[model samples]
Target chain A: MSSFEAGAAGFVLGAACGAAGAAALALANRRRLGRFLSFAAHEINTPLTAVNMTILNFISGALGPVEKTQEPWLKMLREQAERLALIVGDLRDFIHLRLRDGLSMHSESVDLTPVLEAAVESVSWGFSQAGVAVRTRVDAGLPKVLADADRLQRVFVDILYHCRKFRDSGGIDVAAEAGLDGRIRVAFAYAGVKSSARESALALDLYYPARVRKDQLLTATGLGLGVLRLFLREQGGDLSVSNQPDGRSVITADLSAAGGGR
Target chain B: MAAKILIVDDEPAIAENLQAILSAKGYETSCAFDGSEAVAKARHEKPDLILLDVMLPKMDGFDVCRLLKSDPHGAKLKILMTTGLDRMGDVEKAFQCGASDYLIKPFGSVKLLQKVEKLLSGA
Candidate 1:
């Protein structure tokens, strides 16, 4: 072989090796950042929880008797605490969704009735505060689903919380029933707003705000519909958004029935 | 005699706060700062209930619960696992490890006492 050919071959090998090393280092750094973020999110949440619990104790008079005049201040602090927790939760979900691929889930045979009811109750105060009436109906003896109950509850909570921000709409109707195709479908139909195809697509995008019209603005929840879809998809389920001509925007989530109903 | 409770958390403030709350409710309470300490105290103290946190230094709450539950006497001890994360896997692990109940963190005193009372009453 010619000397020039040998030197060229060596140079090519060296360049390929250098590129591979750089790629590996970059991947390692990404993982390290993900771990740090996960750790930071948990550490922040722990102390915040302690603070909130202390606040609750004070408000409930577990520590001592409360004065009537101090009620308003306590109420304000409690509200702020809840807001902070929600923000932190959103951050944690974002970290999992973006940095870590997706959140981990353990699927099992889950009865969705109690989970749906709990999600509604968790966000009931928001609905009332916004003067929005939210109704939920889980058909009797609906087939049990294969899902992570806690993750499903989080999905429902995120949807309900985001829907309540549509205060200008008439109200929300939530219903869950067993489909003949061996799926459990839960639909959230938002009334009194005409949603376009573009609007529906925007709602499920990674970070876009759901805008039905120039005058109507829906506040963004950091745990976006796209993240929910990814979560559902990972568990062999699916999520969809559709618009009806009669001025209803429907968001439907479907989960597989335990044992596939066979 | 008041029912004794053991509170385990790596965070000093959380363990101290839980101890204070339980003590105020007329239950005798003790605190352990880590997983090893939690297991040792549960055996030595033999409290009626142990509020175990999932994340700890030496060992995690799940391992601690599993080890204690394996023992003849520890099988009778009621363990209520607590965690900051709402991960579904953690919930499954807690119950699988023989936890009596599980609570997510930042829980109010009302919820805490309710679970504590229910477990103590074996209802």
Candidate 2:
């Protein structure tokens, strides 16, 4: 080979090696971050659990009352204890996402309607507290989908959490249907858009919007959507969002029929 | 009378575990879960010392501490803020809000007992 050709080949080889090294480093960094987050979660979770329990016991009469002279101080201590637990829980969940590996699937044939209903029920208290109305539209004859029960529950939880964040007093609509390709599509629609940004704009590529400018939805960190996407992808499913002209946002998840087996 | 201690947090297992530990050490232990109820119980109980958590629903620990310290009736109570936040700012803020001292979470039983003993002795 000519010297020029030899040099060109050498350059190509060098570039390939460089790329491989970069990829390896990235993977290592990611794993390290995951481990760090897991450790952090444990640290926060343990104390949070303790703090939460202490408060519960106090209220339940497992611990008796404070004296009249010390009443004001005791009350303040109690409130602060509860707040600490909330912050710790949020931090732990967020860190878990950062440190988690891609979703680990354990699929089985499952009636998804009940799962969705449970999701709705789980958040009903928060919805009522926030004054939001929730509605459902599961097809009567919808086929059971193969899915990881835990992950599927998480998907619904994410959607419901988003709906609760954005809309107050307005109604949320959840509907499921069978697609022509033997896939099941579940959609969550709220009456108002938290943002006018198109569904594509909500793509996972972009970090959650810095601020939710839309009036209808509560401000969200978008971490929930990111985690939901990971879960869906593991089950051979995909999640997408669309912005309707009437200022509504519809989030849909499509799951393959193959996802139903154990 | 032995000094009574109130521990306010939201996690049940932690509370139960700690109750066992402290009760064995001969401290009269009481617990509470949320801010609103914690306040109610404190007013009723008047614990000798309080182990307070910083983050809470309805009201936060700082505000709770401030409310208590501001009240003449509650001003004498010794408040020790306990939390997982190790940030210097959080510690400073806790002290600024009238917390007598601060303890980081995941503390060993020995450390907790030691701190409790110190606070009780000082009081």
Candidate 3:
């Protein structure tokens, strides 16, 4: 065969091999992703179902007339139910965004402290029940941010949930500050780490090596972080993570100031 | 007195609908939104019957039922574990957790009322 023909033949063969490898990788990724999605849905659904059932019982007076002593428990139940509902709604929206079109951003002036406080409070009871201590350093006079409230809440909840998983009894610190160029930055810092295969599998993107235990391996379905990034980007914000020198990990979210536009 | 029943599920629409149907049949109704609250209410109200759901936040229905059954004051209250968990293991777990009866989700209004009546009548 002529040298030119031989080179062309080699090129075609290489192209075919590359295409097959790509297809195989894609298939494997899809299978892994499917399992992750199913597991996440199950984990999320269990809590949601519980919340729903509890609400039903309360409304039906199946628990009896609300007594003065039972009011605090009732309030906690309601708040937790709302929190779970919001998380479920966020997950559903994340799925829809993945399967359908791009996310559309709806920006508004939102008080960052109240939103963060509510998010923290919603999950506080569960953490306390598990013996996890939480500490907050939110700046009182932090400037408002221009962002979608729902998306921001989802991001905050995701970070808080992951932090809770790692630090059982340690404290979680959440702080916000006005950054350069009219940007508002919020950070969550957590100490210690749970080195579990199951947790590694559930870790979102921007996972820090130091944040994870040395013996722990990392795996993810990539759906949660993927949706989170999409939502942030649509809102002209950014999400990032870093392992601090103090054996702690910090996840940061930056958004434009209330009056600032990107 | 006609059986006083408490339906403890979080879904507002489901709770309201169940209350309307049960109340129409002369069953006094009360509700609680979560497992912890359900336990408190059950202790206070001492309803003759409870329609509980398995999936609940914080404590969950099984734990609530267990707590209720273990309590001297709440042991007499009949609990029907009403939930979407139709699996055999789930049903078995409900029974093991002190549920007097188990009802799967999507149960018709007629069937629900019938079951409630049967439980109330000591069947």
lDDT leader: 1
Error of 2 at A33 (Å): 2.3
Off by over 4 Å in 2: A1-23, A50-101, A194-200, A203-206, A210-219, A222-224, A243-247, A258-262, B1-123
Model 1 lDDT tens row, B1-123: 999999999988888778878999899999998899998989899999999999899999999999999988977899999987445468778998899999988777889999999999999
* Quality of model 3 by C-alpha lDDT: 0.69
Would candidate 2 be rated incorrect, acceptable, medium or high by CAPRI criteria? incorrect
TM-score winner between candidates 1 and 2: 1
What are the RMSD figures for all models against the true structure? 3.8, 15.3, 15.3
Q: What TM-score against the true chain A does chain A of each candidate get? A: 0.84, 0.66, 0.62
Model 3 residue runs over 4 Å out of place are A1-53, A56-87, A193-216, A219-223, B1-123
Contacts from the true interface found in each model, as a fraction, amount to: 0.59, 0.15, 0.00
Ranking of all predicted structures according to DockQ, beginning with the best and ending with the worst: 1, 2, 3
lDDT score for residue A233 of model 1:
74
Error of 1 at A32 (Å): 0.8
Return the lDDT, model 3, position B120: 82
Q: Between prediction 1 and prediction 3, which has the larger DockQ?
A: 1
Every candidate's lDDT:
0.80, 0.69, 0.69
Clashes of 3: 29
lDDT of 2 by residue, B11-121 (tens): 656656667667877889999876776777777898878888776767877888888878777768888888763233467789999998987764445666778888889
Candidate 2, residues A1-262: lDDT per residue as tens digits?
9999999999999999999999988988987887687677656676555654454445434456646766544445544453454344444445545555632346778788888987787566556656777888888788888787645875686677776665534778889988877789998888654454544445443245454645424345335465466557767788887766776778888887644421
Model 2, residue A92: distance off in Å is 7.5
Candidate 1 local distance difference test against the native: 0.80
